[model samples]
Target: MAAFLAIIRRDLRLALRQGSDSLMVVMFFVLTVVLFPFGVGPETGVLERIAAGVLWVTALLASMLSLDRLFQADYEDGSLDLITLSPVPLSLLVMGKVAAHWLTTGLPLLLAAPVLAVLLHLNQDGFLILIVAMLLGTPTLSLIGAVGAALVLGARRGGVLLSLLVLPLYIPVLVFGVSAVDAAVMGFEVRAQLLVLSAMLLSALALCPWAAASALRQAVE
Candidate 1:
């Protein structure tokens, strides 16, 4: 318990001290949201209609921006080798990192949605669903993204390649996340969509770390 907390604390402190990564992710989220008003023109109806999709898409891209950092620094400093040799299972350690990543990136994006809700003219009811759906859905992004980050740990053009590998997988999250908000707007129960999002998170939690761990092992070989 202590070692896991220690690892989580260590990563969280590192992420905080070196703040650019989290800041950049929030900036990416904000910038992408800001662009939609211009690209789609100033129709509140149009913005409201598409806001859920736009928000999810921006979050997906912002999360992708941070993926390269997951292991890149450790790989460069040889600390990743030591992590692999540690008494703690690498998958647990990876989960700690993912937890920290969610705190720094995913949680912040969720926090920022209210401001963005205003920007996108999201209805109050829809705003709740958008935030709740993302709360459940974005952890799944971080989990799956950890796999892509680990897979591309040493690959050239890894950023581009990571997007290709993960974006298709992201579709279901976005689809259902947006659908939840849209359903809320139409006065339907969004609990079903929320259930689906939670299910996706659970599935990713069960599956992604092993894939990420396998990729990390291969990266170090």
Candidate 2:
């Protein structure tokens, strides 16, 4: 337990020291969503209709921008080897890093969503649903992204490879997250979509850390 907390604290402190990663993610998310209105034309009805999808897609892309660095820094500096040799299970330690990633990246995106939603004129229900869905979904993204990051460790063009490996896996979260907001906007019950989002989160939480830890072991072997 102490090791898990220590790992989390270590990653969080690293993130704080190198603050640009989180700042860049938030900036990319905001800029990407802001561009949509200009490209699609400023029609309130159209913007409202597509707002949820736009936000989710942009957030997914923004999250991807930081994933390449998830393990790359530690792997390059031999820190990953020391981490693997730690008494803590590698999977639990990996989960700590994943948690820090979500806290730094996902949480800011969640906070920024409302401002973008308003710019897109999202319905009130959709606004609320947007927060709820992102809350449930983004942590799952970080979890799955950790696996991709670990898998591509030390590979050339790892960012490109990471996108290919992770984007397909991200589809389910995007689909359900957008659907939940859309359902709420349409006055339909969003319980089912949120439930599916919860299920995905639970599934990712159970599987991704172990997969990532295994991949990390392979990378350092």
Clashing residue pairs, backbone N/CA/C < 3 A, model 2? none
lDDT of each: 0.90, 0.96
Question: Residue by residue across 37-115, what tens digits does model 2's lDDT show?
Answer: 9999999999999999999999999999999999999999999999999988999999999999999999999999999
Candidate 1 steric clashes: 0
Superposition TM-score, candidate 1 onto the true structure: 0.97
TM-score of 2: 0.99
In model 2, what lDDT does residue 164 have? 100
lDDT of 1 at 19: 94
Cα TM-score per model: 0.97, 0.99
Off by over 4 Å in 2: none
Please name the candidate that would achieve the greatest TM-score relative to the true structure: 2
User: For model 2, where is the 10-residue window of minimal lDDT?
Assistant: 1-10
Going through the candidates in the order shown, the clash numbers are 0, 0
